[model samples]
Target: MTDCDFLVVGHGIAGATLAYVLRQRGHRVLVYDPGQANSASNVAAGLMNPVAGKRFALTWRGAELLPFAAAFYRELEQRYEQSFFSETPIFKLFSSLEEQNAVLARSADHPWGDFVAGFDTTDPGLPGTHAPFGGAWLQHGGHVAVRELLAALAVEGTRAGWLRRETFDWAQLATSSDGAVYAGQVRARHVICCEGAAAVRNPYFHWLPLTPNQGEVLDVECPGLSSAQVLNRGAYVVPVGGTRFRVGATYRWPPFADGITAVAREELAARLSVITELSFAIVGQQAGVRPAVRDRRPLLGPHPTVPALSFCGGYGSKGVMLAPRLAVLLADWLDGHADIWPDVSLQRYNTLQSVGVA
Candidate 1:
């Protein structure tokens, strides 16, 4: 029977990052991943934007999360001897005069003012682009090649003989105060489900208000759009490589299935045209479901009654930035260093105990 200090289910950013940190801290971790192709982390464009939304409000906890994420990814790069993180600036284009005023107004404040590096009153010199009102250069904004990062982590975990590409069965999982029994064989000190959107199906964590959001993004070849920085207005166009960019990312609610569609493609193309008049060819499209929550905060901490069971999911669209710090918090709590933050704790959901778990 395999035995480990921790058994982590799911291999998305949440799971992979947690495992990476835990392993570095000298703990035995066994990761059981279903290897779902359309998982959110695999399909993410990995944009770590400090300022988001129509109001141009600074992201929740962006000030603290951004620097932590940067340093964490830097450490990962050094550890893995690979480069997947880049500090790419984001130019938030003004959609209207009102929006431009809003940016200026918000930039005059505390947190918002702190992140705005400068404003571009005139076009930032991108040919065939429409930025008459200009935009703001956001500080601490960047991109993480999330897919590459996950792959590297998986490779390292597998090479260390701690990762298994298999679906975990809850039916065989039995928890006690000290540890957990998985598949009637594997013994683990704790079991953390980081199953992303699939966590909604987890009997242990199904009660959490996880709203699965379907998002689609396109990869395009735009030779004329040579700006290296990310451009965001109605849509975001991020330069991933030479003459290639990651674009689109339309959000759909009811239709939570992970599948590409013509409507999303058309909407993305139209949005791209609005961002730039340059002709571009669509290279490909990818879609995935984000594990968002009702309050839009992460869901972490242990099951109220089941001490050996825990969870780390529902990071929504901000997983890239949120994972590192949140993982540290979860790992520290597990090791008895501290308690999970009140906002992110599963204890906030009073009805979880009522839903019942086997």
Candidate 2:
């Protein structure tokens, strides 16, 4: 049996970032990944906005976390020798007078007003895609090439003898003569599961209020729309590698399937037809379950009873902005240090242990 310090169950951004943090703290980690774990992290546009839209409020810790995430990715770029983090501004266009007034009002006088910009706009770039009419520009909202970052981390783990690229079987989790087991044989001091939406099935952690969201996306080759600026109308259109735009992300309550959905495709196409000038070709499509929670916070910490087994998941739509810092907190807790974040800890979940997380 291969013993490790940590046996992480997933390899998406949350898992990858957490594993990286653990390894940086001089611990050995063995990751069991299906290479097809479904989560928005792997397939998201990876845009981290300082000011969120729903209520035009600043992201939980936009001032601090945003800078930390930037520095972290830059350090990773130097460490792994890759350039996946793109520092770009996200343009949020106003669809209604109420929305415009809200943004302007908040920008003129708000605690996080520095993140909000008014009046300045992007001259019509793509006709097919919704061009910015007028709204707000949020600085420091950058995009991370999340897939590339994960791939880099996986390579790093394998080189360091820390990652196992394979499907994690459910039967692998069992109690040993002494205590808990991870995967099949990797007995460790502790096992921190970062299994994305599948955390809903973890016997110890399934109780957390993880409201899963099924999201869909379209990968279109909009050669005419290739620009560094991110555009947003009802939805965001992010520029990926050359000529390709990762546009999309419709949210559904039901679970997600790897298979493409006709409803999602139709909705995306209809939305795209609203205002776009670029000649585009649909190149690919993807669907994944977002690890969203009831109060929209991530589940982090160990079980109240099963102290050896822990979890860190449920990072809704803000995975890119939230995962890095949360991972650091989890690592600190694992290393005999106290958990700094008490508000979103799993202990909060066990408060009403009878309630099951969907």
Candidate 3:
């Protein structure tokens, strides 16, 4: 039997980032991950965009989160001696003249002007792209090679004897006021559940309004369109390397609906066409269920009754961008250094005794 400060279940973006933060803060951490290929983190394009939706509203806490995420990834890159995060601009193509005007107007009125690199009303910006209404280049937007990043973290954790590459059995976990014990052995001061979309099955956290949103993405070979920047319209064309770009993703309700569907492929292809005039060949397709919350805010902190148990998930599509900062906050709360913000705290749902998937 071994003792540790934390035993984090599920090594998706949430768990991995939290474990890293905890370890950096001098806590002994053990991560348990079966490493499902279909997990949302593995399939995500890891695009970090500061603005979201058709109205071009600034992302929640974009100004604070973006820079912190960049610095965190850079520090990890230096420690790991590998490259995963890319600081690239996102070219958001305007769907209509009104869309363009609205974004420009918002930029003029708000602090979001700093994020807008430039905008063109005539030139489509990139060659082989079909932006008749032109587009805006956004700063502080980038990509993280998620799989590579996770793999790097796993390697480091494994070498440090802190990562267990096996399924975490809920039946074997026992929590108490003192702490948590797993499999009658490994004891931890706290056990955090970062199970991502699979949290619906977690007995301790299933009550949270966690809605699993199914999403799909495609990897394509676009020979005609070669650019370092991410091109966005209804869908996004993220350049992975060479002429291969990751184009996707389609959001569907009710998790695992039809798994990977032909309809999703066609939908992505249509969106890709709208982004670029260049022809592309679909090389691969992948799907995963994002752990979305009813309120669309991330779920963090501990259980109301079980002080030994906690949760750090419900990041949905923005896990890559949101996890780093949230991990810091969670760690701070765990260390009794700070309180979890009310909006994201799991206690926010204490009023609702029951929550159903919507």
- Best candidate, lDDT: 3
Candidate 1 residue runs with Cα over 4 Å from true position: 355-358
Winner on TM-score between 1 and 2 is: 1
User: Tens digits of per-residue lDDT for model 2 on 253-334?
Assistant: 8545555798988888666655466567888888888888888777888766766778888888788888888888888888
TM-score of each: 0.97, 0.90, 0.96
**Model 1 C-alpha lDDT versus the unseen true structure:** 0.88
lDDT, each prediction: 0.88, 0.76, 0.89
In angstroms, the error of model 2 at 248 is 1.7
Per-residue lDDT for 307-354 in model 3, tens only?
899999999899999999999999999999999999999988865535
Stretches off by above 4 angstroms in model 3 are 111-113, 353-358
Clashing pairs in 1: none
Q: 69 in model 3: Cα distance from truth in Å?
A: 0.2
lDDT of 1 by residue, 280-317 (tens): 99999999999989898999999877889999988999
Residue 16 C-alpha lDDT in model 1: 91
